[model samples]
Target chain A: MRDPGNSGHPDQSGHGQRGSIEALQEHVDALEHQSKTTKRAHQEAMRRERQLRTHNAVLAQLSMNALREGCDEHVARREIVTAAADALNVSRVGIWLFGDDGQTLRAVELFDRQGGFARCQTVIRADRYPRYFEALRENRTLPAHDVHRDSRTKELLHDYLEPCGITSMLDAPVRIGGKLVGVICHEHIGPQREWTLDEQTFAGSMGDFVSLSLQMGKRNEMEAAIKRQREYLRQIIDISPNLVFVLDEETRFVLANKALCDLVSVPHQELIGNSAMNLIKDQEQARRLRKMDEAILRQSQLSIDCEESFTDRDGKQRWFHLIKRPITSVDGSGKQVLGVASDVTERKLYQEHLASMVRELDHRVKNNLFAVMIMAEHTAMGSNDIDEYLHAFNGRMRSMAIGHEILAKTNWQGAMLVEVINSLIRPYVGENLRHVTLDGPDVMLPARVAPAMCMMIHELITNAMQHGALSLEEGRVDVLWKVEDQTLHMNWIEHGTQDVAQFPQRGFGMELIERTAAHQLRGDAQLSFEPPGLRCELNIPLKLPADRHE
Target chain B: MRMAINAQLKDKLKDLRVLVVEDEFLAAKSLETSLRKMGCEVVGPASTVDEALAFIKSRTIDAAILDINLSPGTSEPVARALRYRNCPFVFITGYSNISVLPDDLRGCLILTKPTDPVSLAAAVGQLAEHART
Candidate 1:
C-alpha cells in the first residue's frame, strides 16, 4: 500500500526502484516459505496425533477384549495381531512365542494385509538367527528400518525379508513376569520404510498386551489347579472316620470336615468361623479344651494326645481320643490347631469291661488260693497220713477245677445243675455210669453257688466210693432232683451197702459239705443212714438275697 | 501241727472275743480255727454285712476281722458300722489294691488274702492292742 514517490532511492529512480522491488520480492518469498513449512509441520503433528489416537483406541479395545471372560489365548492372540497390523498400517503383523527351550520362535498367528489372517507356522531357531535372538535378549524394541542392511535383520534378508517382500522390520520382545518370553514382529513391504517412534512404542505395547493375556491364562490355570487340590483334600477329610477340624488362633473354627460337623450337630458351612468352645455341650469340658488349645498356641506344648469326654446335645456322654497339633495357617499368617478325634465311646466301654474282668479274675485267683489253703489244712487235720491227705485233697481240688471249667464255659455267668451233678459223679461212676442214675431238670446255678454245690456232690460220691454202694461192683445209686419254689430238692439213694448201714460218725468231709451248703448257699443239707445205704437231701435257694449279690 | 502263733501278740488275743466276717465258708472256718487256736473266743463268722452288723450290735465284739468283699458289695457298711461303734477292725481282702475303700475306711489296716494263720493272729492282735490303747 506504500507509494513509490516516498522512496528514499528516488534520485536513482528507475535503478533504485527495481532493486527495491527485488528485495521486497525476496522478503515475501521467505515469509511464504516459513508459512508453508509451519503448515506442513502442523499437518504432520496432527497426523501423528491421529495415529496415536488410533493406536491407543485399538490397544484399549484389544485389552478389553482380552479381559473378557471366555476369550481364550488363541482368540486374544489373533485379535492383538490383527489390531496391531491395522493400527500400524503394516504389511504383516505376527505373534511369535519362544519355546520352553528358548532356542526356537514359533509364529502363533500372522496377519497379512493382503492375504488376511493365517499362521506362518514358521519356526526360526536362535542358533540360525543369532543376531535376531541377541537383539531380542535386550528386552527392548528393535526398529530395523532397513531389513536387508540392518545387522539385526540381515541374517533374515534371504530367508525371510526376500521371501515375504519385506523391506523393513520392527520387533518388540514380549516379557511375562519380567522375563523375555516371545516377540511381536511388524513387517513392511515395498521400499524400505522408517519406523516412527510412535510405531515402535505401539509395538512395545502390543508385546505387553500379549504378556498380560498369557499371564492371565497362567493365573487361571493355577487357580483351577489350586481349587482341585483343595477339593481333593476336602474329600479326604470328609471320608475319614475321624473328626477333623482346624481352628484359628482365636479358637474359632477355620475348617471343619463332615465328621466333625456331624459330631457337633451342625453343618460344615455353619460350623466354620464359629467358636470351637460352643461345640462342647459342657462348660467344664469346653474350658479344659480351651486351656489345652491355648497351650498349643503358646507353643508350650507341641501336641496333645488325650482322652476327652463331653456330654452331647442329646445329653449322652461321648468320649474321644483327641490328638491336636499346632500348625501354621495356610496363609502362613498365624498359629492354628489341627485336631483329629476318634469316637472312642465303645472302645472305652470295652476297655473298662476288660479291666473289670481282669480284676474279677484276680479276685477269683486269690479266693481260690485261699480255698486251697483251707482244704490243705482241713485235709491234713482229717487224714492219718500223707497218702490220705493227698488223695482227699486232690479229689477236692479236682472237684473245684471241674466247677471252674463249667463256669468258664459260660463266661462265669452260671452253670447248669445237671452239669454240676454229672461232672462230680462221673469220676466215681466211671465204667458203671449207668449204675449211678442222675435225674434232674436243668437249673442254671449261679457262679457263686457252683463251687459249693460241687463240693457237696463230691463228698457224697467219695463216701459212696469208700464204704457205700460204690464199694460193691453191682452197686447202684439213684440221684433225683427237682426245683420247687426256687428251692433245689435232691435225694441220693444207694442200694449196695445195706450191711454198712450203721451211721458212721460225722467226718470232716460230711461236716464241711453240710457247713458249706448251710452257710454259703443259704440252704440246708441232711444225711441219714437207711437200710439201703445213705440218703441225703438238699434245699438251696436259687437266688441269693438281693443285698447279698456281688 | 498247729501253725506258729505270734509270740508277742498271743496274750492280747487270749480270750479276746473276736468277730469274724467272711463270705467263703472254708476261709471262714480256717479263720475260726486260727482265732480259736490263738486262745480267742471267736464270734459269728458272719457271711454278709447284715450278719456282721447284727453280730456287732448284739455280740460283745472286742476286736474284729473283716473280709472287705462279701459278694455283691464291699464290706464298707460293716467297716463304717465298726468304726461308729469305735470297734478296732482289720480288713482282709483278696484284692491287692484297697483304693476301693471309702474315704473313712482308707486309713484302716489292710491285709491281703491267703493270710497265714500266724499273720492272721498277729493282725487281729495288733487291732486288739490298738483298741486297748
Candidate 2:
C-alpha cells in the first residue's frame, strides 16, 4: 500500500509547479502593460507644462509692449486677449468688465485667431448667461470639461460657441483690491479639450495684468481733468479788466491777479504775503478795509462804494472804487475775501471842476445884476422927463440881458469875442454895420469884460444914431481891436456928422464908458471929438485879476 | 420938501435906536442919511466881523438892518445875536440872490439895494409893527 501512494504524489507535485510558473509569468506581463501606460501619461503632462510656460512668457512680453506704447485700458485688454489666445492655441479670446452698475458684465475686448479682432460688443446680455455670471460674481474660474453636460451653460455655449466651432472654454476673474473687476477667457474651436491647471494659471496672470492697466488709465485721466480746470481758472483771472485780489482770513494778500498787480503798480510776487493795508496810503481807508475784512471773516456779505487812495510802487497816489465780496466754503464754515477795484480818480476831479465852475458863474451873475441896478438908477437920475428915463432904462436893460444870454451859453466862463460882437451888432448890423466897419482878432473875453464892452458898444452906437455916422446916411463908424504884445487895443472911430457939435458936455453914457474901461479894468481910454464925430480908443491887458475885471 | 421936514423933525424917532451892519463906505453913508431922515438914531455901520460883534454887544439896539454878505464872508454873527436878543432886522443886499441868508433870518424882510425912499420907509415901518407885536 505505501509503494502505490508515492507514485501518485510525484505526478501531482510536477503539475502544481508548472501551474505556479505560468501564473507568475501572466502577472509580470500585466504589470509591464500598466508601466507603459503610466510613462505615456507623464510625458503628455510634461509637454503641456512646457507649452504653458511658453504661453506665459509670450503673454508677459505682450503686456510689457502694450504698457510701453502707452495703450489705454481698452487697447491693453485687446492685446492681452490676443496673446493669451495664441499661447493657449485657441481660436477666440475675450475680456468682459463689470460696468458702473455692478450687476452687468460688459465685453471690452474680442480677438479671433484667423481674422482681425472685432470691437467688443456693448451688449453681452449678462442675464442670458446665468452660469457665467455666477462664476464672475463668485470670483471663481469656471473651466468647462463638457459644454453639453451643464444645462445652465449648455444654451449659452451651444448658441455662442457651436456656430464658432468652439468646444472648451477657460474663464478667470480679474481682481483689484480684493474686488472682481472683470474676467479674461480663452475658447478652443478645433477639438473638445479639458483645461489643464497650467492654462488656468496663465489666464489668472492675464487677469492681473488687465487690472493694473485699468487702474493706471483711470489715474491719468483724473490728473488731466484737474490740470485743465486749473488752467481755465488762471486764464479768467489774467484777462479780466477789473482788479481782482484774494485775501486770507488774516487779511494778508494770498493771490493777486495780473490786473490787480498792474493797478497797484506792484509785482504779483511782491503782493503775495503782504498785508493788504500796505498798499493803502490813507490810514482811514485802511481802517475801513480792516473792518470789511472782519465782516468777511464773520461770513457776512458786504457791498459798499469805498473810496480808497493807494500809493503805488512809484509812490504816486491813485484813487480807486473798491467792491469787496466774501467767498465762503461750501458749508459756509470758512471765508476768504475777494475784492474788485476800479479807478475813479478822473471822474472825481471832473466833478470838482464842474462845481467850481458853477460857483464862479453864480458870482458873475450877481455882479451883473448889481451893475444893472446902478445903471438904472443913474439913467433915471439923468433924464428930466419920465418917458426919456424909461426909454433909456429899457434900452440898457436889453443890452445887459443880451450879455446874460451869452454868459449862460458859455457856463459863465466867458464869451467868444466874435459871438459877443455879432450878437451886439445883429440888431444894428443893417442900420449901423452896413455903414460902419467892424474888425477884430478872434479872441475869448472873460465874462466880466463882456458886460462893460457891451454897454460901451451900445452907447457908441446910440450916439452915432443921434449925431454921428448914423445921423448921416453916408456916414460910417469903424470899430477894431488887436492883440499886440498881449495887450488888447480897441478902437472906435466915427467918420461922419461934419456939421455936428464939436463936443457935447460929458454925459452919463460917456461917464459910464470911461469909468468901466479905465477905473474898473485898470486900463486907459482916449476920447477925441474930431470934425467928423467922436473917436474913442481903449487899451487893456488880456488877463485881469478877478476883482478888477469882475 | 416933505423929506427935509422929516429930517428936521427927527425927534419923532429919536428914541428908535437901530443897528446898521454894512461893509461898504458909500452904501453905509447913504443908509445912515436915509435912517436919520426917517428920525432914527443909527447905532453903527460896522465894517467887519469883530467890529459888528463888538458894536452889537455894546449897543442897546431896538432894530437892525444887516448886509447879508460882508467882505470876508456872511453876517451870520449879527443874525445870531439879533435872534438871541429877540430883535427884528431886515436884510439888505445889492443883488436878489439871497442863498447866503441865514436859516433863522429867512422869514425876515429882504430889501434890495439902491432902494427907493418908499421901500426903505415901508421896510422900517414893518419893523415897528413887529416891535409892537
Candidate 3:
C-alpha cells in the first residue's frame, strides 16, 4: 500500500522516500523474477511431457515391429537388439542367453548405434564374477551411472570398462514362463550417463520382449521339427507293400496304403472314408470280417495276426492276415485304430485244395483196394495151382503198381493215354520197349480211367503170354489207337503168328474186355475172330463215363 | 485114401442139383468142379446179368449160388428170378460188408468168394434138406 503520489523510482524520493521506493522497486523486481521463473518451469515441464510421448510412440512401434511375423522369433530377437539401442539412444546393446548349465552367459546378439546387429562373442563367467552375478540374479535392473565403481558391475572395470571406455550400463533380466533365460545390456560410452527412470523402464520392457521372442522361437522350432517327423513317417508308410491303414470307430477307413486300395479294387482317393462292409461282396464272409473288427474295437489293445477271408466283386476269394492296434491321443479323447495286413489268398486257397485232394486220394485208394481184393480172388480161381496164381497175380500187381507210379509222379491229376499203355507194358516188354508198340495221338486220361485201362492192358498182356503175340519169340502185338469222330478206336493186332488157332469159346479175357469197355469206359469191344491170333478193337468214348467212379 | 475121400465128398450132396451163376469165367469153372465133386448136377454158369436171368427162367434149378455184381449190372435181377421160382440161393460177392448189398438180398447168406468150401457145402446141404422136406 504505497501512496498513489509517490514515484516508484528511488531517485525521485528524498532519503526515506527514496528508501521506501527502492524497497518497492525491489519487491516489484522480485515478483517479476518469480513470475519468469514460474513460466520457465512450466515450459520445461511441457517439453518433458512431449519428449516422453515421443518415446512411448517409438517403443510401441518397436514392439509391433518385433512381432511382425510368426516363426520369426530369432528375427524378432535381432529386432529387439536394434530397437533397444535406438530407443535408449545407446552406443551399444547386447543380449546374453544363459546356457543350459546356467553358469555361463553367452552373448546371442549385439547392436551398435553406429553398426547394425551382428553375431556376438561376449561371454560372462558367473563363477569369476561372483558378486556381480549374484547382484544381477537378485535385482531386475542394474542401472549404473559409474559402471566401474558400482559393486554390482565393478568386475568389468579393468577388462571391459577401461578398454571400451564404457562408463555406464543398464541391464534387465529376461524371464520366460517364470524362468530367467537371459539378460539385455544397454551400454553407454565416453561419459558416465545417469539413467533416468524412463530409460530404466524402457530397458526392462526390452527384457520382456526378448524373453517372449526366445520362447516364440523355441515353439516355432518344435513345430517345424514335428512337421518334418510326421512327413517322414507318412512317406515310409505309403511306400510299404504291406496294407497299412487307420480307422475310426465307425469302421470307416481313415488312412490306407496303396496295397489296400488296390486289393479292394478302388482308387486311393475313393477308398478313404469307405466302410469295410462295402468292400466285401459275400454276405457270409462279410459278416465274419465285421465280427473280427468289432472284437478288436471292443478290446482296447492289440489284436495281432488274425486271418480273415472275403470274396471280392469278381467272385474270387480274397484272404488277409490282419493285425490291429488301438491308438489313442495323449488326452485319451480321440480313438484311432492302426492296422497292418498281408494278402494270404493264394496260400489259403492252396491249403483248401490240398485238403480236397487228400480226401479224393483216400476215396480212390479204398476203391482201388476193393478192386485188387476181387481181382486177387478171381485170379486165384482162374489159377490151376499156386504157381499159376503167383505168376498171374504178380503180372497184374506189377501193371497196377506201375500205373500208380506214373499217376503219383503226375500228382494224381491224370496220366497220358500213351503213357498209361506204356507203363502197363513196361514190365512185359523186353529191354527196348519196342516189342509192344503203343501208338496214338498223345492223350491224357483222368485218374479214374487209368485203373480201368490198366486192368485191360493187364488182361491183354496175360493173353499175349498165354495165347497171343508174346507167346512166340517172333510174334509181336501192335496196339494202334486213333481219336476219330470223338471216339478212341484202338486195334490190338497180333503179328507173325504161325498158328491161326481160333478160340474154342469166349474166355475170361473176352468177357472182361466187354465188361470194362461197356461199363467203365462206356465203349464197345469187338472180337473180329480174324484169328490166326487175337484181333480186338475197342471203340472207347474220348470223354470218361459220367459215373465211372462206381 | 484120396479116392475114398473124393467118394465121401461126392456123396455129401448126392442127387443134389445146383446152379452156379458167376460172372468170372475162372470162378464159374472152379465152382462147377466144386459142385460136381459134391455129387450135385451143375446148371448154367452164366457170366452176365442177362445170362443168369435167362438160365433161371428156362431151367428147373434146385439151389442157386449168385455173384452179387456180375459186370455190366448187379445180381439183383438174377436174385428176383431165383425168388420167383421159390429157389433158395446163397450170394458170393467181393463186398465184405452185408449193408452194401441190394435191399432185397440184404439178409441173404452172402459169402465172399472164392467161395469157402465148408460154408458153400453147408449152405447147399441145408437147401437140399429143405427141398426134401
Best by DockQ: 1
Docking class of 3: incorrect
Error of 3 at A181 (Å): 2.6
Residue A80 lDDT, candidate 1, scale 0-100? 86
Model 1 CAPRI rating: medium
Best by lDDT: 1
lDDT for each residue of candidate 1 in A1-550, tens digit (9 for 90 to 100): 9975456755687887787788889988998999999999999999999999999899889878975775677788888888899998888998888888977889888889899988676678889998888898785799999987889899987777788888888999999777788899999988888999999999999989889878877777788899999999999999998989899988999999998877668987788889998776668878889999999998899999999887776888889999999999999988899999999999999999998778878977988998998899888888899998899999999999999999899987889988888788777666548778888888898887888889888888888888788777877889999999888888888887767544566887788777777777778888887767888888888776563433
Q: Give candidate 2's iRMS in Å, 1 decimal.
A: 7.0
Q: Could you tell which candidate, 1 or 2, scores higher by TM-score?
A: 1
* C-alpha local distance difference test of each model: 0.85, 0.72, 0.74
Please write out the lDDT profile of model 3 over residues A1-550, one tens digit for every residue: 9867574666565776867778889999999999999999999788667757766876787667776556487678777887778778889998998898988889888887876766656577788888777767777788988987898788877756677678899999888877777889999998779888888888888888888788778878888898999788878987887789877777788788877777677897887788877876678877776666666677643665688775666777678888887766335776667789887888988998887666556545654564566567667767889998999888877877878888788876678878777667766664666567777788776665666677777787778778777777777888898887767788888876656663325655566677667644567788755555778888877664243332
TM-score of 2: 0.62
Q: Candidate 1, A116: how far from true, in Å?
A: 7.3
Q: Kindly report the fnat of each predicted structure, to 2 decimals.
A: 0.66, 0.00, 0.00
User: Comparing candidate 1 with candidate 2, which one achieves the higher lDDT?
Assistant: 1
Per-residue error (Å), model 3, residue A537: 4.6
Clashing pairs in 3: A500-A532
Candidate 3 regions exceeding 4 Å error are A1-73, A232-244, A254-258, A265-307, A313-315, A321-326, A334-347, A432-434, A438-443, A481-491, A502-533, A536-550, B1-133
Of the candidates shown, which would achieve the greatest TM-score relative to the real structure?
1
**What DockQ does candidate 3 score?**
0.06
